[model samples]
Target chain A: MEILTQIFSLETLSSTLRMATPLAIAAIGGLYSERSGIINIALEGLMLAGAFIAVVVSYFTGIPWLGLLGALVFGGLFAMIHAVVSIKYHADQVVSGVAINMLAAGGTVFMLNIIFNTSGTSESVNALPYWGPFKPTVYIGLLVVFIAHYVLFKTPFGLRVRSVGEHPHAADSVGIDVEKIRYICVGISGILAGLAGAHLSLGVLDSFREGMTAGRGFIALAAMIFGKWTPFGALGASLLFGFSQAVQIRLQGLGIPTEFVQMIPYIFTIIALAGVIGKSTPPTAIGEPFEKGKR
Target chain B: MGVDKIDIKELAIELLIPLLAIIFSFIIGAIIVYTFGYDPIETYAALLQGAFGNLNRFADTLLAATPLIFTGLAVAFAFRCGLFNIGGEGQLLVGGLAAAWVGTFDGLSVVVHVPLAVLAAAIAGAIWIAIPAVLKAFLGVHEVITTIMMNYIAYAMVAYLSLKVLANPGEIKTPPIEASAYLWRFSNILDIRSYMNLGFILALLVLLFIYYLLWKTTIGYEIRAVGINPDAAEYGGISAPKNIILAMLISGALAGLGGAERTLGLYHYYIQGFSPGYGFTGIAVALLGRNHPFGILLAGILFGALSNGRTFMNMAAGVPIDLVNIIQAIIIFFVAADLIFRQFIPNKSEGGVA
Candidate 1:
């Protein structure tokens, strides 16, 4: 009973919201790419790049908002490389994503060495301001989720994205410009994933550390899958994972193995994919390149 | 005879593309180095010197390449069956734990104990991948997501077991394995002071075994047939699901052997975060090698050199070690999308990207 109260306390709930913001935002980012028929496992890299960029910009300019803007712009440009490789060159999407991740992992540290002469971390920067109990990025995260839900399900652009994912040839027959839609969708994912990264560096903490995202980008991918690729579903899934993380943090001193607690979200993701929560299918042509005039 | 000529020509192209990719990546890496105000020639010279300046340094390079050969082969073996096995890291970790556990057994002969520990590692790795393989084969779940998820689970499980259940008092690592389980180091035969072990030989043997198995066996034929076209292979009476499971099991075992090599041969105990993304580096190796057995061997060696020599580059040339990783990523990009090379080739024959 005591544990139950501790788990559901106001502080824990607020922590849950804070923890879920990045996952929800990143999941929405993944939803955009996967829904447009591109398998983007590069969210981790994009988020890392964003976190690094946010810290660097904030450290230089002394404005957290401007840092967030820098992250978004750079993240999109970084993702465009994946876009060009996978879409134009017809590379395997997963392999391309792996390369993108490696680039970010190496590039960030390389830049850190050059810019700060430190290999492990950056200088602390001004963090994003909080409004009420939560940071503004948290509110922006929620707003992005609702907007993603509307834009993905209710708009003509959403219809075209969905069609391109389902059957690019059919969408191409109708002059929907399948390749262009995929490029834009992948770009949008990069932007949102960048926002998630900024939230981590500028919202949750004040500086970027080496590999600090620590597979949260991957957790977001799991959330995107667990949510069945819907924005609202992703939000719900993120909250569940966030709740687990919150509970884990609160339970740290109570002799519970923290490693097992950490395993909860990932193990749940595997179980979710194994169909315990009903069948979750990806976009029909999710990993395939949009080849024009081909069967 | 004509078919043989065509086969040789095809093999030449297969080899040429990867070679081209490596060269292009180096050129790009050089440009990046120059842009960063470093001397690219000096940086690369230092890298080569550090990797092979002496017998001792060359041995260190081989020691670094040892586990990579296993992981590269693991990835390549699964790619042959049209399955992407990205769970190598998880499998490797569990394998290390299993080896650590088995190596603690009391009073066995060196030969018996060593083989037993290695077998345990391989079996543990195979078991680690079983869930992902089953999910992928039977439920239509993509192995990429499942395997990656399993990696996190493995990380947690290994950390819990090593730190909580197996660690010696007040230390972050498991108890050292019995001396009987240790893989003999080359220092026994050579004057080198490095930790290079019989594991390098083991890696070469496994490489040869994989080559023979994939090209000379009925199992390899079916695996390749399925990889080429599962639907067509199914129509031709091969069981796609069964082959998928078998291939993944073997792949996992290979990755597990990599872990065993590190534990019994190098560390003699399961250490936390022992690997610096060797499993992930295996992906780059497999791609840069074009998924061929011999090619994987060379690619693994190249990456191993980069990893081993980066320290010298950092110390001598004032270049960051992370540049190796950037070059590695660029290599993968060029290799995966060979169309980037098509721009440079005049009147290239048309085919899908390999």
Candidate 2:
């Protein structure tokens, strides 16, 4: 009973929510891009860029919100690069994504070493002002999730986006701007992912670390799939993953083997992904770049 | 198409694109280095010297290329079969662990023990990818998403086992393999004290085997057919699902063998960071090689040289190792955009894709 009590404690609940927040935000970002027929594997890299830029700007400006804004702008810009290479230039989506990841990883490390004279980490910067013991930003994330869901499912623009993902050629024949929709969707993905990164640096840790986003973007991708690409479903999946991570941390505190505990979330993710694999379907045109002339 | 006629013009055009891409990327790298107050020419010269300056350094380059050849081949094999096996890292980890397990156990003769360990690693790798294969084949799931997810799972599992269950009682690594199972290293003659070993030969054999398997067999034909057009393959009576699973299994086995080589030959024990992103780098290598076996071999060696030389470049010319990474990224970007350059250059054959 005591063990159960500890497991179900308020601290555990809050920590779980906190851990899930970044993943939830990133998953929502993934949902937008993927639903619109673009596979945004670069979310991880984008988030890292956001986190780094947020810290750098915040460090210089001494305002956390500005840091957040900076991240959002840069993240969007990075996504634009993806849009140009994939949507305009007709580059392979997967390869373009890989390029972005490599660029982000190498670029951030390079910038860190050159500008900050550090490796794998940056100096602690002034964090965004916390709203309370529980930050108001968490609520903002939830609100954005709901808003994004509403926009994706209920709006006319959402329908067009969905159509483009299902069959761009058909969508084009029907007079929908396939390229435009993809550009917007990808751009939105960047903004949301950037916010997630900003939250990591300014809200969670108040500093940037190299590879801090680690595989969280991939985890969010998994959550998006496990959630079947629906916004609410993605949230549920993110919470589940977050809960696993929270449990791992708690178990670590109890002197349980930390390594085994660390494996729990990843193991659960793999199992869940495998189980959901054949059953769930991604958007039809997920990886295929939209070529204007091709049938 | 006349096989006898050599179209020099077409060949030159084809060469133009890759050449321009390389030149463009180099220019970008030079600018970045110049921004840092470093001379690009001197830095690159130093890089060359460090990578191939001496026989010892050249050996080191080959050593680094050894496992990469396997991993790159593994990735390219899957690509040819129309599956994306991003789980190479995970497969490698499991395979490494299996080989380590077999190696630490004493009793068997060298001939039997070594082969057994290698087979176990291959089996372990095959099993690792089997789940995703089943998902993709039966449920219509994409391998890209599933394989990526599995990579994390594999990493975590390895970390868990290495830190607790499989870890040596007093160390963070597993027990070293028995002498009988150990791979023969040629460091004694090289006098360089580097870890390069006979695994390079094994890597070469695997590459040749992959070339034969992919191009010389009926199964290879079916796999390639499925990759080009799965529906056509299915219509022609080739089971797409079976082929998918088989390809993944083969790819995983190769990756597993790569891992085993690293453990039994070089490291002598399993440890964290054993790979250092070899799995991801393999993706770049496979792409640069254009998914051809011979191309993969050349690309693998080039990457190995760059990686080995980066350290030397850092020490000799004070050029940051990050520059090499930038160059690598550029190479991948250009290769991925190879078609873009194709428009400019008509067709000229380069040595190989890499």
Candidate 3:
């Protein structure tokens, strides 16, 4: 009885929202790219890059907002490497995504060595201001979810994005620029994933550490799939993951091993993929390179 | 003679692409170093000296390369079956734990104990990937995501077992295995005081075995057929689902052998965080090697050299070791986007009419 009360407390709810914010934003970001037929396993890399950029910018400028902006721009720019390789060169999308991840993991630490002369961590910087009990990015994350749903479903641009992902040939025959739409969608994913990173470093923590994003980008990817690649679905999935993490934290002192708690979200993701909650399918042509004349 | 010449030329082009990608990645790495106010030549010279300066360093390189050879084979084998296995790390960890547990068994001879521990590791690795394999085969879930999720689960589970269940008092590692389970190190057999073990030779034999298996066996034929075109293979009576599961099991077994080598050959026990991304780096190794056994051997040695020498590069050249990772990433990028090479060597098939 006491455990149930502790698990359902207001503190857990607030922590859930805080943790879910980054995941929700990143899932929506991944949704944009995957819906446009580009597989983005690089969300983890983009978020890490964004976190490092946000920390460096905020450290230099003493402004958290500017750090957020820098992260967004850098995220989009970094994602273009993936876009050009997979889109223009017709490289295998998964291979390209893996390269992006390795680059970010290496590049961020390399830059840190040059800038801070330290390898493990950077100096503390100004963090994003809080609004009431939560940071502003938390609220912004909620807003982005609804806006993404409207833009992805209710708008013609969204229709084109969906059309390009589902059947690129049909969309191409109808005069839609398949490559262009894919590029924009991938870029948008980068921007949103960058926001997710900024939320981690600036909104949640104040300093940048090596490999600090851990596997949240991956969890966001799982959330995106678990949500069936829809914005609201992603939001709900993120909440479930966040709630598990919150409860995991709460159970740390209750004699339940922390590692067991940590396994919950990943286990849930595997179970979800196993068709326990119905079939979760991706966009039809998600990982294929777009060719104009090829059958 | 004309046919032989054509085959030779095609083989040359295939080999040339990876070589050029490596060279280009180094040039980019040099540029990045120069831009950051470091002397690229000095840094690379230091890196080379550190990697091959003496017999000891060379042995160290081979020692590091051993597990990579196994993990690289793991990834490459899965690629042959048209699967992306991002679960090598987890499989390796599980295998290590299994070997560690088996090594704890007392009163066994050297031959029986060693093979028993190794077999246990391989089986554990296969079992670890079984869930993802079954899901991918039956339900059509992409192995990429499923395997990655399995990796996280493995991390947590291993940490728990090592930290809470099997850990020695006040240490984050399991108890050392019995002497019977130890893989004979070169220090004991040869004059060199290095940790290089029989695992290096074992990896070489495994490489040859994989080559023979892939090129000579009917099972390998079916696996490759499925990888190239699953629908066609299925139409021809090949069981795609069966091959998918078999390929994953083999891949996982290879990864497990890597973990077993680390435990039985090097550490003699399972330690928390024993791997420094050997599994993840295997992806880079597989791609850069063109997913071939011999190619993987060379790529594994190169990566092993880089990893072995990075600390010296850091201390002697005043260059961060992370630069090696940057170069590795650039290598994978170039390898994946080989179309960039079209400018240097024009495509022969471009202008021919079908």
lDDT of model 2 at residue B57? Answer: 88
Which 10 consecutive residues of model 1 chain B have the lowest summed lDDT?
Answer: B1-10
Worst 10 residues of 3 chain A by lDDT: A261-270
Best by DockQ: 1
lDDT tens digits, residue span B1-354, model 2: 232246776556445544566678778988998998888888888888877888888888888887788888889999998788878888988999999988988889989988999899999999999988998898776777777777887887888787678786778898778988888888867688668887888888888888888778888989988888899899999999999999999999988998998999988888877887777778877887778788788888988988898887777777678777777777777777665676554334553221
Write candidate 3's Cα lDDT for A171-194 as tens digits.
999999999999999999999999
Cα TM-score per model: 0.98, 0.93, 0.97
Q: Which stretches of candidate 2 lie over 4 Å from their true place?
A: A252-278, B1-20, B345-354
Docking class of 1: high
TM-score of chain A of each: 0.98, 0.93, 0.98
lDDT by residue for model 1 over A1-295, one digit each (tens)? 8988999999999999999999999999999999999999999999999999999999999999999999999989999999999999999999999999999999999999999898887888999998988999999999999999899889999999999999999999999999999999999999999999999999999988889889999999999999998998899999999988989866776788888888887888888889998877899999998767667
lDDT of 3 by residue, B1-354 (tens): 221145765577779888999999999999999998889998998888888888888998999998899999999999998998888999999999999989989999999999999999999999999999999999888999888889999999999988788987688999999999988898886667679998888899989999888878999989888888889899999999999999999999999999999999999989999998888888989988889999999999999999888888888879899999999988988888888874567557665311
- By lDDT, the better pick of 2 and 3 is 3
- lDDT agreement of model 3 with the native: 0.91
Any residue pairs clashing in model 3, and if so which?
none
The best candidate in terms of TM-score: 1
Q: How big is the positional error of residue A187 in model 1, measured in Å on the Cα after superposition?
A: 0.5
What lDDT tens digits, residue by residue, belong to model 1 across residues B105-139? 98999989999999999999999889998998899
